[model samples]
Target: MADWNAGQYLKFEDERTRPSVDLLRRVPLSDPQSCADIGCGPGNSTELLVERFQNARVIGLDSSPAMLSKARERLPGLTFVEADIATWQPEERFDLIFANAVLQWVPDHPGLLARLVSFLKQGGCLAVQMPDNLDEPSHRLMEKVAHEGPWASRLTSASAAREKIGSFEDCYAWLQQAGCAIDLWQTTYVHPLEGAGAIIEWFKSTGLKPYLDLLAPEERVEYLRHYMEEIAKAYPAQADGKVLLRFPRRFFVAQRM
Candidate 1:
C-alpha cells in the first residue's frame, strides 16, 4: 500500500513463507535453466526457488522499490528487478515461471495467466500460489469497512485493485487453454499468531495496505481502530492469548506442452 515496508512484511515471514515452501515442493522439474519469481516481495519466494534450482538463473521481480531494496539487501548475489508484473515483458523466456501469492493482485485472470504461460520456454513449468481468503472474516471485514461511511468513495480505487481472484475452475480452464498439464489444489492453514492485535498487524503489510494507503493519516488511525475492533470480535484469543488466523490459499503448477 504505502511503498511496501519489507520489515513490516517480514514480521510474519515464517507464516507467510510456509506457502512458498509448500508450493515450491509441488513444482515438478528436473533441471530448469532459467526461473523467475513474479511479485517476489523481499525475495522470500525467490529464495526458495534458488535453493531448489541451485544452478538456474533465478531472478526476482517486484513493483515496490522498498521491497526490492530489502530483497537486494538480503540476497545481494541474486538479481532483483523493479517492474510491474501486470505489464512486464522479459528479454528472455524462463524455464520455470513461479508466481507465489501474487496473481490475486493482478487483474484479468484469463489474459494474465496466458501471458505468463507464454513467458515460459517449451516444456517449462508455470507455478502460481495466491490467497483465496476473500470469503474469510478478515477479508470480509476489509470489504465491509471500505464500503461503509465516508471512506467508500475514497477507497474505491483500493477496492478495485483487490477483489480480482477468479474461481479456481476458471484458472484451471485457462491453464488448459494454454495447453499445460496442471496440478491445482487448495490449502487452509490455521496460523497461531501471538501477541495482542496480531491479526491487525498481519494484514498491515498485505490485505489492509490498500485501505490504509487510501485513507488520510488521521483517517487511517480511525479506520484501523474500527478494523481492529471488528477483528477482535471475529478472532478471539486463545487461553495463551494467541490468535488463530485461518488463511486459505490456492496453488497450481502447470507444465507447458
Candidate 2:
C-alpha cells in the first residue's frame, strides 16, 4: 500500500483528534517525566502531550514518512521518529505512551498491547484509542464494494490489512497479564458533516485506504462511486442537509504496576 496522505488525514483534524483529547483526559499520571506518542500521525496528538506535560520529554513515532514530515513541521522543536510500532524496541521505557486511532491497523492485539505496556515504566500509563467501527455501514460497504467488482480478485485479502479490535473483556485480561490496572470504555460520536461526499472524504484517508490502494485508478473511481451511492442510502440527510457519521471508538488507559 502507498504511504499515508497527511493532507487528506488532516482535512477533518478536529474530529480526528477529539478522541485523543478525551483519551488524554483519563490518564492518571501527574508530571510524567517522559511521553511517547505512538503512531503519532501529523503530530496532532503529540501536540496535546506537549501542552499538558510542559516539562516532559516527548517524542512522536510513526512509520509513515509523509506523516512524520508533517509532524516535524507542526512541532519543529520536538523529536519525531520513524518507526513501526509492531516491532519497535525502545532503548528506554516511558512515563506515558499515547496511541490514538492507530492500533486498529496493526495485527495481534494481544501482543501489541503487551509490547506497549512493556515500554511503560512501573506506574506509568498507556493510553489508547481505536475505532471500533468495523461493523458500521461505512466499513461494511467497503467490503461489499470490494467483493462485487471486477477488482474483487485483487482485493480479496485487502480487508485483512486492518485487524478487528477485540472485546473489552479480551483487552482487560491482556492488560491484566501485563501487570497493569485498566480503565476502559467505548464512545460513539455522531459527527455531523456536510453530506455523503464529506463522509467519503473522511474514510478515504482511513478505512478506505487499504481497498483503494490495491485498485487501479479507474477501478478506485468506480469503487468509490459505488461506495458513495451506498453511503447516501445508509445515512439520510438531516433537515440542515448534514449527514451524521456514527463513529464508535474504544479507549483504555492502563497503568503498569
Query: Which residue pairs show collisions in model 2?
Result: none
lDDT of each: 0.88, 0.95
- Per-candidate Cα RMSD to the true structure, in Å, reads 1.3, 0.6
What are the runs in model 2 whose C-alpha is more than 4 Å off? none
Sliding window of 10 residues with minimal summed lDDT for model 1: 159-168
TM-score of each: 0.96, 0.99
Estimate candidate 1's alpha-carbon lDDT, on a 0 to 1 scale: 0.88
Q: Which candidate is the best by lDDT?
A: 2
Residue-level lDDT tens digits of model 1 in 191-234: 99874388888889888898888888889988888888888889
TM-score attained by model 2 = 0.99
